[model samples]
Target: MVRWLLVLLMFTGMADAAPPSLYSLLSQGQYQPPMQVMLQLEQNYPGVITQFDIDVQNGELIYEFNMLDPDAKTTVGFAFKASNGSLLEQKVAKLESDDLEELAAVTLMRQKQLKFSQLITLATGELDAYLTEAQLDHDLGISYLELKLLSAAGRHKLAFDIANLRPLPLLKWD
Candidate 1:
């Protein structure tokens, strides 16, 4: 009888461990589709979405997007609640003139060079590394691709220049 009770408890716990369904998440007033949020954002501030993803911040699911302004000179970040599609936060920053110039140059260069996937393959050259983030650094005059790598030693950050596909120095934070 004790063994049967233990088995029953295990099964009951497993039932509670099931992941939340989309309907449930929406009903709870906590999550919403990122695209829906983006549509609303565009209506207010027109821009092109450069990045979009769902992430958990502060124990709540949030839809995040990086938008390139219609003027093609500034980038903006927007975060919305996943459950109700409500605006959570927005960040906008102006790009430096020099950075803008560099960005234009890089854009032209990328058109004639290898794509991101090809560059990653070339950079890795047979290693357990995955691309984490890719961003254009106008200040540095280069596009940076961040890689998460696992080796005999441990996990490490590997940065590479997207323009020339050359490895860049990685900064470590303690």
Candidate 2:
């Protein structure tokens, strides 16, 4: 695991020589850019680092990373400059998810003819939204809404009845 640790250290820690010309970090779900990574990126690249934005596009192994205008909320897909923080190679992609899937807990109440394939797609969408919206930013186990969304697709029924289970307020995923 020493090699892994070294790579992780490289995320935020200083390089023995210079900023990595090209680099990558581990991510299974949400790509929370570690503070150390940002610091090192800034130190090595200076003004080019700019701001980091985290997002998940389903059906993908890696999350699509982006830089944003801190004030304007403008998004760019590629490199920023050390000279002036100008975003470069900014090719705009069409979309992440075009399907209308929702994770709202109320989805369980709907009994519809959504296909098995369609169900998984919808459930995945809802799961993504729920996880991103939770106060803690993640839930280890499936909750009422997640199960319900799945049920709409015939994957699984709402296992536990959540009568009084009000979901906590959504938290900002920093």
- CA lDDT, every model vs. true structure: 0.56, 0.29
Which residue runs does candidate 1 get wrong by more than 4 Å? 1-30, 70-72, 96-174
RMSD of 2: 17.2
Return the lDDT, model 2, position 100: 13
Model 1, C-alpha of 84: deviation from truth (Å): 0.7
| Number of the predicted model whose lDDT against the real structure is largest | 1
lDDT of 1 by residue, 36-147 (tens): 5656775677544444555655456777766565355787788787768888798987755544543553464356454334444566677643222333343355555454
Model 2 over residues 5-49: C-alpha lDDT tens digits? 889879866645643211211223233333333344434431122
* Local error of candidate 1 at residue 13 (angstroms): 19
TM-score of every candidate relative to the true structure: 0.40, 0.19
